[model samples]
Target: MQYGFLYQFFFYLFGVIGVASAITFVTRKNPVAAALWLVNTMFCLAALYIMMDAQFVGAVQVLVYAGAIMVVFLFVVMLLNLGQPSAAADIKGTGARIAAGVAGLVLVAELLVLARQKLPPLLPDLPRGTNITVPITEPLFRQYLLPFELTSILLLVAIVGAVVLAKRRG
Candidate 1:
């Protein structure tokens, strides 16, 4: 299906915004600000997902990543008292910075090479229509039900542990 010029424009717009937000999120010194930037990145991703005809995925991206996950992260950040200046030193040493720069350059090169190459699909294509989640969700809720519940329990345990740590710190 051919989309209009406006649709293409907004798609690229959101993509750019998402990338910029992600960079800002990483470079932010304040953890709170960084988390907020991550939320912006997530919202931009949701927009891109919607534009790409994955409305359900977009909604899940916003609700799960942008909403629920971000809240939990922000909560943890607050509980850990990360907003204040700590005795710990930031990324010091020129050697580490240079290594990080090299790693970033290598990643960029890999991305450019991947962009030029046409990689075969990792999974088989499905029927084109809505209900895209049906295939994955069915297996997830059935075959993978035990693992899914276990993951949720793990997350709950982690949150409880964080709370305990915060209380101990206080």
Candidate 2:
């Protein structure tokens, strides 16, 4: 009841922050600044995942996306010397400004719609002293093991590709 309400409130709070941060990330002209804003967005998303009771996913979101991936992005930005400040001539014209305003209004309307909705319960109540990790791990290892290993392999390939590209550019 009360707990659920609090959870919903925080969920919306984090959701809004995540949306705003994502907008900031894309709007920034400086690549480093944009990457930092993206990291903020990732953190907000991780908070949302935790609020939804997916603790393992949330932790991975922060550790993998915000930590590891962000470091890689920042490193690449530095390696490419992309830290130079954006030119002042990049300002938007009147039509672009109006479009941004309309997009903002759309976001507000969506938020209002979310406010009126109640999320269905995620799980039946767990018994006292139940370990949360057990539920998450059992299914991940037994049912989803192949996909998990494939994802790891994919990530490794991406990292190797990045290294090769960087070397070519250097």
Candidate 3:
């Protein structure tokens, strides 16, 4: 029927898939399976971005996160020959699990408080045909240039480090 209705439907569906994928990513014993789950999660997020009308962000999410980042993850998994299932003994203990659960609850509470305080009310009707490209891009390149470059460099370094760690020592 309406575009907004379709968008909302897909949004909820993808959101559920994203959460499921994230859980699978964490719980899967196989490295490849975890990476695959992560990739699925990224794709769902990209779909959500598209539903929000952030075309540039959606494309970047798919291209950079789902495509490039997942490729790197898969490469590392393959290079390390992480084919075997993780040993059952490597799982965390009950005390660590309790601590992690408590930490997660605290984080959720903090996020809820922050969201309640900072989020503006959604406008009933956003201005039609509004263009945000220049507004968004100009500041990203001009004001945040250094931080952006640094982030890219940091990611590159992480990739290199992963490669080095996975390589066989001569």
Candidate 4:
């Protein structure tokens, strides 16, 4: 389907905002601030996903990642008293800084290569009026059922562990 200028405009707008928010997330010194920025980035990504015709995935992204995961992260941060100045250490020293710079350069190179790829659209080439979630939910529940259950169990374990650790330390 032929898209108009507005489609492209919103796509690029969300894309740029996503990238900028992700950078802000990384550069933040406070873990809570960083997580909030990360949530903003996730929202931008969800918008992009919706724009690309993946409504279910976008909704899941917002609900699961931004809502659930970030809430867990912030809860853990608060439980562990991470608001203290000494809770995190800066990446000091010339060697560590140089290593970080090299890693950043490698990431930039990978992104450049990814940008050159002519990838297909995420959704299938079905009629625009078709229900998209039916195709996705089938395999997600059938083929990937085990992994999905395992992921939930893992998250439960993580939460329990965090609580146990916090209680012990307190």
Candidate 5:
């Protein structure tokens, strides 16, 4: 059907864009550019998650990673006035090239092995409706209550430590 073909096309397109954006995130010299690329990459990943029928995950990916994290990164970059133009650095020296080549080979080998394995099929009778109605915080407070409280306590301690350190004078 036409819909199936369109879905497949978009799936591959978004996947390729995600990978390209990830590479750009790491390779871009400017911090702001890297953060922007990271946001783009997160958006692409959210698209991929939607294609896989995980609507909640996709929305959270955009809301948390792309929106919140990238906003914080951009704000910090702006506050610090990190507007320096990207300088071209030597990235293809022999040692660096060799290390990159080895990493690529390892990744390719892992992919090949995974491709050879047969994945289990999803249940045919499973619900197709996207469950986006439930708020994530509800489960965190109800089911994962203890862990959530502990994490908040840990974060508070970290914030207090940071403030104490910043206030110390010579």
Candidate 6:
């Protein structure tokens, strides 16, 4: 395939980004910074998914992992006051601010790239008019419905717990 090399290049690029971000996520002492790194890792994974022609999965990666999940995690972190910067924190106020600014710029750049690039599929002649989400949705809504609902309920419980904990502390 003519695009095989291009595909491979992006795969490795995003793969490296994902791994690096994951490592950064683990190493950061600041919860917010760690969460930002995790978000970056999610974006890289989404890019990799799109590269592999799983556009639906990629969109879900962005929308669910990067968007909804991160918001929830950040909400929990904030509620727990885990993002408060102390003098003893690995990144002090100035350093944390700098890191956040850089992360924001990088996020904007990555989103722009995602919006601008139109990638050719690795396989040239996939059948047209086939809805990509059908296979995924069928099992997800039918077989996994209970688990899905349970996960949502669990998240709701977690949010309520966090709120209770925060209220008690304050």
Best by lDDT: 4
Cα deviation of 61, candidate 1, in Å = 2.2
* Model 6 clashing-pair count: 0
After superposing candidate 4 on the true structure, give the runs of residues whose Cα lies further than 4 Å from its correct spot.
84-89, 115-129, 152-156, 159-164
Highest-scoring model, TM-score: 4
Global lDDT of each candidate: 0.86, 0.87, 0.84, 0.88, 0.83, 0.87
Model 6 CA deviation exceeding 4 Å by range: 1-3, 85-126, 141-170
Per-residue lDDT tens digits for candidate 2, residues 1-170, read 53678788888899999999998988888888999999999999999887766777889999999999899889988887879866675668999989989998999999999999989965755465777688888988999999999999998999899778767653
Candidate 2 least-lDDT 10 residues: 121-130
Q: Write the per-residue lDDT of candidate 4 for residues 97-129, one digit (tens) a residue.
A: 899999999999999999999988665555768
Worst lDDT 10-window in candidate 4: 83-92
- Given candidate 1, what's the lDDT at residue 100? 94
Residues 24-138 of candidate 6 have per-residue lDDT tens digits of 8977888899999999999999999877768899999899999998999999888778786555746457888899889989999999999999888654533578788886788
Q: Count the backbone clashes (under 3 Å) in each candidate.
A: 0, 0, 0, 0, 0, 0
- Candidate 4 residue-pair clash tally: 0
Candidate 1 at 137: error in angstroms?
A: 1.9
Worst 10-residue stretch by lDDT in candidate 6? 121-130
Question: What residue runs in model 1 are displaced by over 4 Å at the alpha carbon?
Answer: 1-3, 79-91, 119-133
Error of 4 at 3 (Å): 2.3
lDDT of 1 by residue, 1-170 (tens): 25689988898899999999999998777888989999999999999987666677889999999999999899888877898645566547999899999999999999999989977755544557758778668989999999999999999999999778767453
Better of 1 and 6 by lDDT: 6
Candidate 4 lDDT at 129 equals 82
Error of 1 at 51 (Å): 2.6
Residues 1-170 of candidate 3: C-alpha lDDT, one tens digit per residue: 34587677888999999999999898888888888899999999988886776767888889998888889878867877876786665568999999999999999999989887956665453356766476568888999999999999999999899789968899
